[model samples]
Structure formats: C-alpha cells, structure tokens
Target: MGPLNGFTVIELGGIGPAPMGGMILADMGAEVIRIERANGTDPKQMRDVSARGKKSVVLNLKQPEGVETLLRMIENADVLIDPYRPGVCEKLGLGPEVCLQRNPRLVFARMTGWGQEGPLAHAAGHDINYISLTGALFATGRRGEKPVPPLNLVGDMGGGGMLLVNGVLAALLETASSGKGQAIDVAMVDGAAQLMWMFHGFQAIGGWDASQRGANLLDGAAHFYDTYECADGQFISVGSIEPQFYALLKQLAELPEEEFGNQNDPALWPELTDKLAAVFKRKTQAQWCEIMEGTDVCFAPVLSFMDAPSHPANVARNTYIEVDGVTQPAPAPRFSRTPSTVSHGPHSLGQDTEATLAAMGFAESEIKQLLESGTLGR
Candidate 1:
C-alpha cells in the first residue's frame, strides 16, 4: 500500500505519455483502470514497458449506453486521464465538463503535445514534433548537424508524462483540502521548454546561446562532460565537471601536466577531448568500469538496454525485475513505510470490462446488453 492506495484513476487509452503517466500512478498503489475503446483494434500491440500495473476495460463511447457506462465509472473515480487532440474528448462526451459534473472531486488530467486552446491543439504531432516546436530538439546533438532524437525521453516521458503525474497528484492534494477538483492541461511542448529552465537562466545572464546546439556545458562542449567510444566500439559517459573530480579524472587517465594548464579554456576543449578519447580507447569499457565506476572521475560504461539490468549497482538495488518473463525497470522513488509493488502486468483489452462495470454498480442485465450490443468489448 503506497500513498495513492485508495485513489481510483480512469485512464482513457491513447499512446506514449498517457500510458506512462498511468503506470506511475498505478505503481504508487493507485487503482488505474484503462478505458479502452470497444473496437477490433488490439490493445496488446501498444503494451510496452509503460502499460504495466493497470486493469483494462473497454467501452464504445460512440453508443449512448457506452457513454452512460463511462459516466458511471467517472462518478466513482478520483481522477480521469486522457491524451486526446483538444476537441476529441468533448466530442466523445467524456470531456472534463461532463465528467467533473458527475463527480466534482474528479481530477481531470488532459495530456497533449501542444495544450488545449492553442492554434495547434488539434494538429497531429508526436514527441519529436512537440519538442521541435519548443526549440528543445534544436538544442541537442552537434553543431551544424540536424538535431538527434533523444529517444523521446524529454518530450514524452519527462515533459508530458511526468508533468501530468505531478499535476494530478497536486490536484489530488488540493481536492483533499478544498473538497473540489480541477483540470490539468499538461502540454509536452510546454513541459520540454520548462525542462530547459536552467539554460534559460544562463541565456538571461548572457552565458548561453539558443542557436548553438551541443556547444553548451552539459551538451558536450565542455571536455569534462561527454561520451567517448572505446576500442571495442562500446561507449562510456564521463562527467568530471567539478575541479576535484576533474583532477581525479586527469590523474586516473594519466594525462600529461600540459593538458592541465588550461583545464577551463574553451579553446582547449577539442584538444582535450581528442586526448581523452585516445586514452579511453586504449582500454575496454569493462576495464575502465573496474577502475573508475565509483571514483570521483564520475565515469560509467554506457550499457545497452539488455545489459543494464545486470550491472552490480542496479542488481543490488533491485532496480529492475522480471515479470511475466519480461525484464523491465522497477517502479521508482522507494517508500519505506508502505512499499509499492506491481499489481499485475499489462492487461488484455476489456479483460476487466464486466468486473469494472459491476464494481461501478452496473447490473448484470445491463452489462449483458452492453456487451451484446458491442458497447463493451470482451
């Protein structure tokens, strides 16, 4: 039992960030019910690392009876999360206005690439497009090269999903005090821009450039913070930015004294990077890990997805687990009092349709009719 043990959340299924947000809440002991469309489309296709710890219920919102069924669940739910193009929810009659009316204490969370009322709110977009609009994508990768996709982490997970989770939790707290709920419009573009807040401060102080990609301190312009490829073609990331750590890095790498003469000089970054690269290439990633894993040099081998779980630190901490024969990272931010656990794996679409309906006070006869009319998927 985690902090959110008693909370019930209704997740209107979409993709990406929305599911990820639901997973976070579900991991924290919230009872997350995924409201899937009663269509022929398979739900398992979208089931990846993010769809764990949830129950699935399908309903045909296009049908009047289906809409009634959803309203009934909303009445009992503490939160309802949806990732839809601005007007889609309103059209489906599951919008915040209707749902909140049914349950004034419902925390209605709307996730989108571009927010609710913007001109591009209805425009089709994904993580890349959203980050691109906010100048976030342009800030990654090397100078004079197209921006590399950062695996959709910043926009999709960090921005969209994480922000929605925070907002929903905050709204829940507010509801506990005020006895009312509100809507949260979490936009990926907005959240990505917020993620660059520190850089924004640097720009205001004239220490940052908006146009120079990969030329900033944390973006790889500084020799102390960057990735290097080894002779084995494996990579390692290093971040010895502080003076003490940088000194340790130099000593560990056995660099000559001349290289230390201008450690902070921007003009020397390229030369230093080349020298460090050559030295790192002399050893395999594992060899370097043995020497520097827990040192002040701030070094770690860049393990692949499959290799990450086996690392000593991760394995010792139980950072990843195998569930249903699937290896995935464990839920984060440990709670000592009431520890969290994954209730179950990603569920089949509409697997709990009748169960959810019955819990929401739907009679068996009505459930049979809805199921027979294709208003609820089996």
Candidate 2:
C-alpha cells in the first residue's frame, strides 16, 4: 500500500500541470482517477513521460449525464484537481460549488495560468507566458540575452503542478480537523513568484543583483560553481563553494596555487572561468569523474537522458529502473516502509472505463446508454 493508500483523487481531464499534480498524488499511493473524455482521445498523447502512474475513466462533461457521473465520483473522492480555464468547470456544473455540495470534505483543486480571478484569469497562456509575468523569466539566461525558456519546468510543473500538490495536501490536512473542503486556486503566475522566494531574499540581503542574469552566486557566474567541458566534449558540473570544497576541487584538478585569489570577487570571474575551462578541458570527462566523483567538490558528469539511467550512482541508488522495457526514473523520496513503485506504464484512454464506472456504482445499462448518446464518447 502507498502512503496515500486510502486517498482517492478525481482528476478532471486536462493537460500539463493538472495531470502532473495527479501524478504526485498517485505516486504517494492515492487512487487518481483521470476523468478522460470518451471520444477515444488518448491521454498518453499529451505526455507519455510524466503521464505514467494513473488510471483513467471517460466521461463527457458537455452532457448532463457525464457531469452527473463526475459529481458522483466526487461524492467518494477525497480530492479533485482541474486545470481548465476559469468558468469552464462552473459551466459544466462540476465547479467547486457543486462539488462541495456533493462532498463538502473534498479538496477541490483548481489550477490555471493566471488564477480563478484576475484581469488575465481567462487568458490562454503557456509556461513561458506564465513565468514571464512573475519576474522569473526576466531573471533567466545569460545577462543582456533574451530570456531563454527553461522548457516548462519553471512554470508548468515546478510552479503549477507542484503548487497544486502542496495545496491539495495542505487542504487535506485541514479537512482532517475542520471536516470541510476548500477551493485551491493555484495560479501558475503566483506559484512562479512563490518559487522565487529564495532569489527574492538574496536580493533583499544584497547577495543578488536583480538586473543581471547568470551573474548570481548560484546562477553560474562564479568559476567555482559552474559546468566545465572536458577534452572528450562531455561536461561536468562543479559546485565547490566553501573554502574546503574549493581547495579540494583545485587539488583534485591539479591547479596552481597562483590561480587562487579573492574567491568572491566578481571582477576575477571571467579570467578564472577561462583558466578553469582550460584546465578542465585537458582531461576527458571520465578522467575528471575518476578524480572528483566521490569528493566534497559536489561534482558530477552531465549525463544525457539516455546516460542517466546507467550511471553508477543512479544505478546504485535505484534512482532509475526499467519498466516494460522503458527506462524511467523511479519514484523518489523513499520511505522506510510503504515504499512506492510505478504500478504500470501508461494505459490506453478509458481502458479502465468500465471498471471505474462500475466501482462508482454505474450499471452496465447506464454505461451503454451514456456511450450510445455520444456523451461518454468512447
């Protein structure tokens, strides 16, 4: 059994963050019923990667019967997450108001780019647009360069999906005592700003410059805390910040004593970075790994997606596993007991429609009627 073994979550079918939020719940052992549409549209097409570890049921919210079916599922669910734009769920009659009426103790999680209410609440936006508004995009990439999009990590999953997970979990905790559920308006923009809390503190303490990108201590401007390419063309990341770690890194790399002076001086970075780059390039990445892998220098070879699974450290820790012949990351944050594992690979859309609907008390005749009416779509 998973840590969330007894918990049930009804995931209103959508894309990106909502599904990922459900993935987190499912990872912890919650029964996440992905409420897919019955039109035979496969949810796996959205993303075969993070879309793993959940079950799906088809129900067309456009039809009254389908909406009713979703509400009935909510009646037994402890949490429900939806990423539709504002007013979409309300129009479908499966909004927080209706859901709370059916199950007041349900955690109604609503995720969106802007939020449930705001000037841009209904505006269609993606990860780039969402993080752009939160000062996050402006702070990314090299200085004076266009803000390079960090592929959807900053906004979609990190901010939007992970924020929904935290919100739902917090609301669940509150429900244990209050016996009431609440709407979780998790806005991607807001979550992005929340994620910048550390950077905000650094600026407040004068440790960071808001105008510069890639210039901060943690942002790759420092020679001692950055990625270096080796002779083999592969890369290794080094983050030897402290004096001891820096000394160790220098010793491991066989650097001259004359190269050391004023570690925190911003003026010395460009030259030091050049020198370090030249030194690192003298040896192959493998050679550097042999010298630095298990040290306090916080070094690691920059493994590609295909290489990560077979890395010694990852393999030793069981961080990656082969499932159905697919190499993927294992469930993280391991437990002393009640360890989690991916139950299976991605299933066909509505593959569990009959089983899920039956478990929710739908009869065979009702399922047939719904399917025949073009409501269930499947």
Candidate 3:
C-alpha cells in the first residue's frame, strides 16, 4: 500500500541513525526486518518511536550457524543497513564483499560518523563531535556563547540516517536499470558538511558574515527573523524577511515608521530589536496570535514537544499520530497515490524470529536445532 511495498530491507540494528533510516523505509512500506543481537541490549523501550513499523529477529552473529542463516537471508534481501564502526561487519564475515557476492543486486548501506577509512574512523565519537567537525555546531547558538548541541538532530538523524536512506534509494534505482548493486558509505561528517552548502554559498558570495555567529541575517541577529518572548513568557518566532512582510509586522506591532523604517540597516538592528522586543512583551502570546498569527507577517508561536501535537495547524494536517498509546509523527512526504502508513507498532525482541526463519525456508527441524544452540534467541 506504500511506495516501497514490494521491497525488503534488512536492518542491522543499532542506536541513533540506522534504526531511524530503517523506520523511514518501513513507513514507506518496505518490509524491513531488524537483525538484533541475541544477547545485545534492546535499544528501543516501550515508547521508542523510531522502532515503529518494523519486525525484529534476534541472531547471534558470533555463531557460525547464525552468520550462515544471515547469508541465506541476504541471498533474497534487497537492502542491508550496517550501522557499526568500520570493520565490525567484516569481523563477522558479513562485509559488503561477502554480502554482495551472495546477492548481486543487494544494496549494502553503511553508516558512520567518520566514514569507512580515515584517521578518526576507528575512534569513538557522537553526534556532537561529528557536527563540531562541520560548521553546523559552531553556527548555532547565541553570539559569545559556546556552541550548543542541536540534540543529535543535525548529525545523527539528518546527516547520518537520512543520507543513508537517500543513498539506498538512489542505489536501488540504479540497480533496477543495470541489474547490479553497490555499496554506500554514509558519513555524518560528510553529510553535515553537505548540509551547510547554503551557508558556504553565502560565504562565497559575501552574503554571509562568517566572522561572528549571531551577526548574520538568519542567526537570531535580525529582529525580523528571531524569536521573541510574549507577555506571558511564552515565545513566538517571526520570519518576516520580505519587505512587505516586515512592513506588516511593523504595522501590526504598532511601531512608528520613524523608529522602524530602516529595516535592513545593521547599525540600527540592535536598537530596533530592543524596541520590537519591548512591544511584543506588552501582549500575551494568545493576543499576539489573534493580531498577527495568520497574516503575511510570517509568525508562529514557539511550541514545545508536548504542545506541538495539539497545535491547530498540525492537528488539521494530522501531522502527529497515536500508535499503541504513544504519540509520534506520522509518515511524511505524502504521495498522491500509494500514501505511506504505519502498518504496526514496535514488536518485542525476536518476536518474528521463528516466523521469519520459517518464511526464509528454514525447516522446522533446523529451526529447532538453531534455537537449541542459542544461535537464535527465544
């Protein structure tokens, strides 16, 4: 019922990005099977949103029988997501060379912070370290303050997971034509850097000032593009960058032309910002919403996580959904036909192991042997 309805993806499960990529594919109707370690930690708890719409199979890759079983599954799988550090899959005898040899049309997608080979590829690092290497971390936060971590959204989900999904889809398309598959090396550092292309272009053309963080147009320095606190201490964001929208903001806020006329003057920005802040503070958020929410002023109240699902715009669009008593975002990039859906909520560890192995043509006797040997978890 989705765009990737017939495709099958094998997710070598880990934390952070790889699971997110797998969930995206599953949401798009790909039959995603997560390969979890028999004795490894279950990264997803009861409310873990990223585990949605996927099936789990526990396999002890340290066992030769388990590796052989995975190879058998790879023979018919379309995609494999590897989320480990470099050479970990090779140590398990499940590297790209082995897997691609087993299935010529398989897409082997590998994700990492530092990529396959580099000085720091073997070193351990998190999203903060990866984004710090790029300019993403440094460009964030207020001026004169240390860079704040953007909650792993930039490096892990945006750069690592989404980049892997993109590469997988592209490779799948190419394989459809050439009848050959390829390996994808997705690095968070590389993807995060690529994400900064706009700023890089701005810097190249002198449209951006890289000298200071908050002095730039979009970096909270501009009064028209920053968040303001309302009378009730709630926050609202304003992005009235266009002159017409800026004029509307000025009119709605009742700012005199003499004080707010020169909108783009950098020297006047501080004084004007103070005046605008004071004006916004005079009214509560609801009052400001009544005055300026849906106008050409480009305004929206800053909604927290708990408050976001119930927002009028989001509720109208069904942007958030509830599954198994947990509220999370719905499948995105709506399609005119074959729209995506969440088939089911998260499954327990090894919930589908026996059924999956049986579907993979493992005889009942062999399944019993594997289970007895601890190659397959209960």
Candidate 4:
C-alpha cells in the first residue's frame, strides 16, 4: 500500500545490513523475496526484528541449477540487493554484470563494509570497525571517556542498509526515465563518512573542538544540550539552546537566570553544567517532567524500550505496532495516500519456496525436479 507497491525486489540473504535493507523495502510495500541458503538460517535470524513484511525462498547456490534459478528470478526483479564481499557473487555466477545482462532495467545494489575494490575490500569487519575508519566512532563518546559504540545502527543500519535502500530507490526513479538500470556500490565506511559530513564542516569553521569528543556545541559539552541524572537515578534530556528556552529552563528549575551569563560562553560550560546537574539531581525525573514536559524547555525523560511505547507522545502517534505478539516500531516516513502495512512476521527458511517459484513462472514439474535435485529446499 506504499509508494513502492508492485515493485519486485530480490534480496540475497546475508547477515545484518542486507536484511535490514530488504526490510525497509518491504515496509515501503515492495514485494521483497529473500533467498535463504538451502541449509537454512540460524533461529535468531529466522525471528530477526527487521525481517517483517518479506517472503523467504531457499536455494543451494553451490548447484548450477540453483544459480540458474536465481538468474531467472533476477530477470523479473526491479531491484536485486547483493550483500556480500566484492567477488563472492561473481564467483557464484550471480554478480551485477551477469544479473544486469539478464535484466537491463534491474537496479543492482551491493552492500559491503569496505567496498568492491580496496586494500580492505575483502577484510572481515563489523559495524564498529567500519565506523572506526570514518571518524564517526572517534567522536561519539565523552571528552575523556572511551568511545562508545553506537550499537550497529550507525554502520550497519543507518549507513549500510539505509544508504543501500536510498540508492536503490534513486536508481529505480532514474530507470523510470532512462529505461535502464545501474549498479550501486554501497560501503559502510563510505556511508559512515557521508554521515560525518556535518562534523567536518563544524571542524573547518573552528567552532568545533575536534581535539576532545564532548567539547562541542551539540556534543554534551554545553549545559543546555545534555542529559542529566535526576534524584531517583533516572535521566532526562534537555536542549535549551535558544535564549528564551534557556531562560524557561532556569525559571522552571527555580534557578536565578542572572547566574547563567553569556549562554554560548564555552569557558563557562563546566561550571554551568555542574550547576545544572546539581539542580536536576535534586528532583526526580517525574517531578521535573511535571514542570517541563510540555514546555519549550525542550525536555524529555529518557525512556526505556519497555516504557517508550506507552509514553503519551508515542502513544498518540502509534509509533509502535504489535506483530505476532511482539511490539516493534512501525513503518516510518508515513505515506498519506498509499500507506504501508506489515501483513506478517518473518518467514521460516524456504517457507515460501514452492509458492514463490510458482509465482515466478516455474511449473510444478520444474519445482519438483529442482527439489529432487537438492537445488531447491522445500
């Protein structure tokens, strides 16, 4: 029901980012068909939180028939996402060159940590390593603290998966005019570097203190743009950068507005942060929420995963949905005319094998032959 409705996508199932990219496509109402290994995937992946709204098909790529089957599916697919190392798919005879040769209008997307060709192209790494090389990991933590990993969100999902999806969508839009598709080489490191573009400008302007991590306008160095611990050990975030907002914060906290001089004075940040911390610690998070939750003090209590869905604002917007008894975030960037919907949870390995192949125009005899040849796992 979304903008990408009727678009056919074939996902070469891999761990992490590729699955996430397929999920994003599926959430946007694309017909995503994931290719699983004949041996099947791990139970953890079978129930992956990001695997909703897709179908699964299994194939033994080691067999020639299996590779042929995939190529046939590529002929009908608009987008083919290959999440692997540079030559892995080429070695399997399923690379972009081969696939695009079969389908000139197919958008081929490759998501990798390094890239198609580089010194570290074939090196094994994860989200942390990818972001580490991009300067993003170095600037994520406190001034004096060890850099904290921003989960796998930055490199895996945000940089890798989201970037791949964006590339695929752009390629699709272009294909509408050109009637020809192209390959997208998406690297997690490249995406991570792209994400750090804003910080590069901040550094060039001499306003950012690149020497230290936390010493920046938006990096928790300023008192008005940081999180504080309350009396009950709970926390709340504040972003009162504007003069009126900062004044309101002081007024609500019962602190003298005159004590805070020159709001942008970097030299006075340490002292101002100390004072604000003390004031915030004197009250429970709930007590502070009562006074500032809806005000321009730019306040919000730090909500845990369990409590976030029930928060008044989140509840009002239905930010989360229950799928198979599990509560997870809803499809985002909502569409007004063609809204997206999750019809089911992740499919078990090869759960849709026969059905998907049949829908792809395989005859029952062909499906049975492939199954008997061990190329297709039913």
Q: What TM-scores do the predictions have?
A: 0.97, 0.96, 0.98, 0.97
User: Which stretches of model 1 miss by more than 4 angstroms?
Assistant: 40-47
**Top candidate when judged by TM-score against the true structure:** 3
Give lDDT tens digits, candidate 4, residues 1-378: 888999999998888988888888899999999888867664235567677888888898899999999999999899999988999999999988899899999999999999988999999999999999998888888888999998899999889988998899999999999999999999999999999889899889897876788888888899999999999999999999999998898889888767785789988998999998999999999999999999999999998989999998999999998887789989887999988888688777788899999998999999999999999985
lDDT of 3 by residue, 249-313 (tens): 98999999999999998778788889999999999999999999889999999999889999999
Q: Candidate 4 overall Cα lDDT vs. reference?
A: 0.90
Give the runs in model 2 whose Cα sits over 4 Å from its true position: 44-47
Q: Which stretch of 10 consecutive residues in model 2 shows the poorest summed lDDT? A: 43-52
Which 10-residue span in candidate 3 carries the lowest summed lDDT? 39-48
Q: What TM-score does structure 1 among the candidates reach?
A: 0.97
Q: Rank candidates, lDDT, best first.
A: 3, 4, 1, 2
Across residues 1-378, which tens digit of lDDT does each residue of candidate 2 receive? 678888999888788898888887787888888887666557565446555778877777877888887888799899988879999888888888889999999999999999999899988999999999988988888756788888899899899988999999899999999999999999999999999999889999999998888888987789998999999999999999999899898888888878765688988887899999999999999999999999998899998989998888888999987755678778767977888777877777887777887787989998888778866743
What is each predicted model's overall lDDT from 0 to 1? 0.87, 0.85, 0.91, 0.90
Please say which candidate is ahead in TM-score: 3 or 4.
Answer: 3
TM-score of 2: 0.96
